[model samples]
Target: MNESGNPSQPVNVNEYDASHIQVLEGLEAVRRRPGMYIGSTGERGLHQMVYEVVTHAVNEHLAGHADTIDVTITADGRIRVADNGRGLPVEVRESTGMSAVERQLTELSFAPKPRTGYWVFGGINGLGLCVVNALSSRLTVEVHRDSHRWTQEYEKGIPISAFTRHEESSGHGTAIAFMPDADIFETTRYSFATLSQRLQELAFLNGGLAISLTDERPERPVRHQHLDGLHAYVAHLNPYPSSLVHSPAIGFTSENEEQTIFVQVAMQWNTRPPGEFRSFANSTRTHEGGTHEHGFRTALTAIINDHARRQHLISPDDEDITAEAVQQGLTAVVSVKLAHPVFEGCTRTRLGNPEANTYIQETVREHLAVWLDHHPNEAAAIIRHILNTSI
Candidate 1:
């Protein structure tokens, strides 16, 4: 607010505001600016929408309300996500003056806090459920909670009718049946192999989470399940870590009491220079490294140098190892489970978590350093591997 009855900074054509405010009603804005919500209108964006909704389903499993999640692409261009969770809450919402079932079926954009939103969801944009609904021509949600089975139909994100409950026999989970709106999408169908690989990655990250998919369109459905968690994830990425580590594991975590960020790292260095690194911010893999990654690197370098000094491993005259040198031939995953993951950009590729840097640095510095000392043989083997396995 300003003295002349204007904002402190009067927004001009160059600024964001009233004119910039997108008053997209129904699904018009989604078709126009699909990228803003799904991150793109292309393959990545298309996959994002699927993942967003799937993540919403997964959140229930993460909360112990689910056990099995199945995703499959049907020949008719429908995506079916079935989970053994409690089911989508369908009570009435006092805020929107609509039934909770209606919101889940036709108008959920982002995950709402329980009661406030009435359920746990892992939607990145909050508009995930709604966006998917609005983009698709038809969306249906079936929930079997408390021994009562119910279903709802949505056409382009609008409910054709309120939820109708039936006392028929039903599974004790929730099933969402949706057909991607062909009008909004270039292709309403999905790829089995691509989606399978993604689902595998997620299963690996979540550990003990089982997901199965059957591509009925192909005569036989494609199915996969991973119970190994990150251990399997590490093994999948670097199959020969044990041979390289001289011990059972390659890189390990350093834990401390005042951990402001969850520092979980597993790395296997190969002979490749500038070793490949992957990061995740609260289960969403950050393809682009963020502040958490920065801190992890800093801690990694410091720990190695300190260890070198204690063991007289490196001649004082030798140059300290470079980031590339440390990473060379290494497949490392750093997963930070922060309370709230603030991404650097709208696409959420990088974690813009500032506090993660310091938190990781401190914890790793203390814990990893001590671990290396106790596992002297393993440390020496890794240091040697880094020196030898470079292009």
Candidate 2:
């Protein structure tokens, strides 16, 4: 203050606070590099736009929602997703005292966490909503909860209107309808088969969960199986010409205060194809196969090798039972749980956690070994098949 020897503006405490927090508003960056958020500007990304919208509903389903999701590709080219679950937040902002819905639709980095962790993070990235809104020419979000329905409209993530309460009868859930921006994405159309495939998998993996996918664009609607859950999933995907000893799938699930894990093991001697297994944190597939998958793979390989050596099924000089050699025709699914999910990349969302590896490995190792001992014939057959395949 004395450096200038003038009435140096009395150093004020409030004025000394850190510089104004820098923030990129609206869909500014998303529009600049759409691929950075949605992965690519190709068909995959086009499909991703739909996924981004439907994931919210699927997430609600996981959280014990009202149940039922309706997806329709309107003739007018509007993709509509409706789900029975807690609706997106639309309360008043405590800071600006403005409607939360208005702010989220109009601003960047504005999203509500259903829970502390990304447990309900069905969105591709935290940018799921923003990305979709930014990529769409027009967007509308309707929320039905607490016996009241509210509506809001936006243009590319920027709210154009305030939330309006609608008095609708016999309605509860969230509906999102958006028209993709042709300028932002090359193709704005969606593939029903691809979408159906993903939905069918979710239905199969989640027992007692009913998911329906209908393509109104085509006169003949393609329907998928709604029952059988993971058990059916394994059977359907089981190897062809399998000499299964009839090893029923064993499903194990555990949840801590932070995470939830669901594991299903279906082992049979099949002559169809290579082994297949996947891990999931929430509904999003862990394409890379995280810790839980690692443990499952390791334990399975080790267990098979141990059984083979003890049964004298293979000569001591045989190979070390590589993952590929052992999983020639086996099928299993290992799903992990994480409190705060940190998905890899924006579009290719996969679970990233080290602890899941230990849990899955230990559980499968202890249980599968005992299962093998209990069912000698099945274990021996599998090990023999693996050894034979290796040879």
Q: CA lDDT, every prediction?
A: 0.70, 0.69
In candidate 2, list every pair of residues with a backbone clash: 204-229, 291-357
Per-residue CA lDDT of model 1 for 1-391, tens digit only, reads 5446777766455555577676776466766777677766666766766787788767776567777888877778688888888787767667876866666545535346632211222354455777887777788888898678988888877788678788965567878778876666666567777788888877876667787777878745655556656656767776555344543444445434543345667766554445557787767778888898899888888788778767877788877877666766666777776655677766667878788888888877877787788988878877887666533
Give the per-residue lDDT of model 2 (tens digit) for 48-86: 888887776666676776467777777777888887777
The TM-score, computed over Cα atoms with residue i paired to residue i, of candidate 2 is 0.83
TM-score, prediction 1:
0.84
TM per candidate comes to 0.84, 0.83
Give each prediction's root-mean-square deviation over alpha carbons.
6.0, 7.0
The C-alpha stretches of model 2 lying farther than 4 A from their native spots are 1-24, 94-97, 116-120, 168-170, 220-227, 239-250, 256-267, 309-320, 345-351
